[model samples]
Target: MSENRAFFRETVEQILADTLDQSRIEASERRMLPAALYKALEENGVTRMLVPEGKGGIGADIGDSFAILRAMGAAAAPGPIVETMLGNKLLAEAGLEPADGLIALAFADDGAAVLHAVPWGGGVDHVLAVTPSGISLSASASWEMEAALDAADEPRDTLRGSLGAIVALDTSATLRTAAILRAGQMLGAIEWTLARSIDYAGERKQFGREISKFQVIQQMLAELAAQLLASAGIAEAAADAGRETLIAAARSRLGDAADAAIGIGHQVHGAMGFSKEYALNHRTRRLMAWRDDFGSVQFWRRRLAGGFVTCSREEFWPAIADAGNRRAA
Candidate 1:
């Protein structure tokens, strides 16, 4: 890792270690924001990491931001961390001042009347709406909110309101940006699951021996480790390249990795993994919740397939080669 990224990761890890805990994570599960944790993030300028340096931010690279997000996922840090970081950048790009407190993020469709599954819609006072025309900020009071939750029991409310004032900007990149970042989160959660499961296997007893000694158990963990490495590599590439096709592929591949984590991790832990009180359930459930965010696995798979389906036999190889070269560049 670069010096800056290593420092960035250490800082995020410290903030999370200091401000986030099991109790706070449980409160978040019940739909409450970890105010202290977010306050620490804001106080440290972590929330504004993406905004340009000219606009009161450190102007950190996407890799730096991705490392923080991956750490958040591993820790299961609650609230709209990703949303706030990206939202501040959007606001700065539009020459608007940075927002305090939490900000929900949504990409509104053309002629869409309501924004659905908005992350932390009810908890946050502001929403950053990115559309084909422009990006805009809308106050929470202007909208009627319908309460909802994702698989992890985190808020994913719906909102109906005007987008307030629109700021002209190219809004095409938001979804891809969100997708690759969310994929990083998913990768982190999967990593947690695999680590927890392996540790448990080593300590768990079966047939007068550690379960980890069994060939079956060893194979399962080995497979999960392989999946984690693959997901981590692709996710890093997607975050670095920011290509729509690469992001789609990364999200789709990570979906399978998440499933493996949930299945293998739970199988290793047996009944303990299913308990609501156990820590493993937290990361596993989040894997289910976040896998579909930004875009569903099926949706991304279809998107990736669409890119290749239109090519002839002669053109397919070159298209694939070009994509790889572009991503490498």
Candidate 2:
């Protein structure tokens, strides 16, 4: 990481450490936004981290912003931080003024009146809607919301109304960016689970000794670690490069990693892992909820496969080679 990136990461970590706790997280899950936490994030420039420097943002690189996102996931910080950051950037890109307070992001078909399962939809200041044709922003007062929750118990409300005039833009890039940033969140959650499982294994004794001593437990942890490593590498690269094919690959690969993290992280802890009071459950449930956000694993898999199948036999290897090239010109 660059010096600037390190500073951003540390600042996010400190904010999370100070503002987030069990009660606040639980409150968010119950559909109450953590107002103070969002305030702190905004005060620290995190909310506008991606907008241009002249526009009151840090003008941070995509990779640096993504690192902060990963930290948010690891801390299991609540609310729509990811959406707000990207929404502000997109708003600036369109020469539109950024909205105040929280922003919720959603995708709907062109000409659609209702947007469903929008993250933090009911409580945001504005909604940044991305469609096949373009993007638009609408104030919260312009729409009606039916409150709901996702598997993670976070707000995933439905909005019924029209967004403002759509500005022409590359919607695919918008969706890909959302998908890969989500993949980074999943990566951090998986990392937390693996670490938590490891710690539990070391301290929790079975029959005669620590569960960490068992060959089977060691094998499982090792396998989970391997998955986490691979997922992290690809997720970071996709964020840095913002390549469509690479983002597809990262999302698909992280789906597998999430599956492993939930399985192994719980299996090691036995019944204790399933309890709501346990920290492991928090990250695991989020992994389940977030895996299909922006797009599903099957959608990305099809996207990845579709990207390569269009190439002739002679162009196949180079295409695969190109997708993995993070710094490709």
Candidate 3:
């Protein structure tokens, strides 16, 4: 890793350590991070890391942003980090001011459908909704509410109904970026699950011996570690590939990691893992919910398969070679 990226990771790690209130986060679940935490992040410009310096942001690269996001996922910080950061990048690229609070886009199945802005909570100053076709800006409108599919209990809602309007920015790149960001978040969750499970096994005892001493327990941990490492590598490679490549890689790995991590984590902790009082449960639940968000594993798998089927084997090799060369160079 570059020194700059190391520094960026350290900076985010410190910010999360110092500012994120674990007690409050555990209590609220999905209800946005505390106002104080949000203020601190905003004051430090963590929330706008993707925007250009000229646009009142730190002008960080995607790699740096992903590192920060990975830290957030590891810590399990509440609120919509992917949605907000991607929205900030989209707005900056569009020459618009980055809006504060939660910002996510709502898209229809039709390829040319307009995306509408949905706030994280009830109200925000502005919302930017971008689609592959174009960018849409709405300042005054009643935000629609839909139920979130994730496990977080805090204020989760989706956007729907006629109160919302869509604009066309044709920004497929931004949507792809958001997907990559989600993959980073998944990586963090997987890492946390593996580490936590190992720790729990070592400390928790069964039959007068440490559970970690058991071959069965060790195998599970080893498998989770391998999956986590592979997923992390794929996610990083995908992010470097840009847009669709990143999304495909992330979708493939995150789903597998989430399933493996959550299952093993619960097994290691046994009943404790399912208890709401346990921290492991908190992290695992979010992993379960997030895996389905953006696009479910099945959804992305079909999409990826479709893409591959449409291309001849000859065409696929060149695309893979080109992507590898881009990352290498």
Candidate 4:
């Protein structure tokens, strides 16, 4: 089983290596969907990765889904891969077959459904209207995407047209699933940022010595490495346990890693990191944007606080310890 997982991981890595070239990243950043790359993901079964094979899908578990998400994050594959995977899972949960083509979160505002900061919203054929009432699938109201600054530049669009059909499912489940997926994506972002930072630090010289040799630079790298490991652990635990609190913690931890790693990444890259032409921004911008994607740090922090409030003073330490014990195991 482990070997199978390893092979899948390598296969994903190779696919991203071949598909997410510099040209595609730039085009995606410009809010344009790389049609070929999107089709490649579909052909490889990633579009239906989370759905069961019996349902005309791949039937991949959360672990496999997350692995693919992380690879996309690392490669800066821009589109609705995450949205499509989670949306398909939710639809399957409701025993509803998702409409073909890409899918995105359908944000609710009053009576209308809207999508804000939607990745590749313009590129998708369907906008998933996940509301408190139920889950509704709407055809792309309009591909007329509004503007966004984050170079991942996933076109954000609003839903104006009438909804087709809706399903009954807990809204929290969708949020938790999306949040967990975002956390996994952060793992890839942090890793990609660290890889770039280390490479730059080792190559760029200061005072006839590589920047990587400096104690300050080394310390920052070490801190990012430690945080990345913790972030990965939190994400894995949340995926395994399905605890809302753990999921929130994973998102919070990911936000923390984004804060630190984004700083260290740009610091090592100097001015070039922020330059529009540089590849570092492709990964780093997404990290920064995703920190607040599903839920910001403050939001998750409040969610965690609510969870802890249930425990009495006497049970506090035990509760915390038990959670840690479970994570360790």
| Among all candidates shown, the one with the greatest lDDT | 2
Ordered from best to worst TM-score, the candidate numbers read 1, 2, 4, 3
Q: Write one digit per residue (lDDT tens) for candidate 2, span 160-241.
A: 9887889987766788888877776788899889888999999999998999999999999999999999989988988898
Task: Provide the TM-score for each candidate, comma-separated.
Answer: 0.96, 0.95, 0.86, 0.92
Q: Write the per-residue lDDT of candidate 3 for residues 1-329, one digit (tens) a residue.
A: 67977787787778777877668677555444566666777787877989999999999888787888888788887776676777787777777788876565544443432233232533344445555555655542454555443465644455543323444455656655777777777788789889889899989988999999999999999999988888888788777666464466567778988999999999999998988877787677778777866767887676565555655878877766554332211
Residues 1-329, model 4: lDDT tens digits: 26655666677788787767878878875667777777777788778888888887888777777777788888877777788888887788788895588897765643553456666555678777777767877666554456555535656554345455567777756777788887778889899999889999999999999999999999999999998999888888787666777887888888889988889999989998889788888888788778887778889878776766777999877877666332211
lDDT of 1: 0.86
Separately for all candidates shown, the number of backbone clashes (residues 3 or more apart, or on different chains) is: 0, 0, 11, 0
Which residues of candidate 4, in runs, are more than 4 Å off? 109-115, 142-151, 324-329
Q: Residues 155-264, candidate 1, lDDT per residue (tens digit)?
A: 99999866676788887788878888788788889988998998999899988999999999999999999999998987898788788778888898899999999999
Q: How many clashing residue pairs, candidate 3?
A: 11
How much is 199 displaced in model 1, in angstroms? 0.6
Q: What lDDT does the true structure give each of the candidates?
A: 0.86, 0.87, 0.70, 0.76
Q: Could you tell me which 10 consecutive residues in candidate 3 have the lowest summed lDDT?
A: 110-119
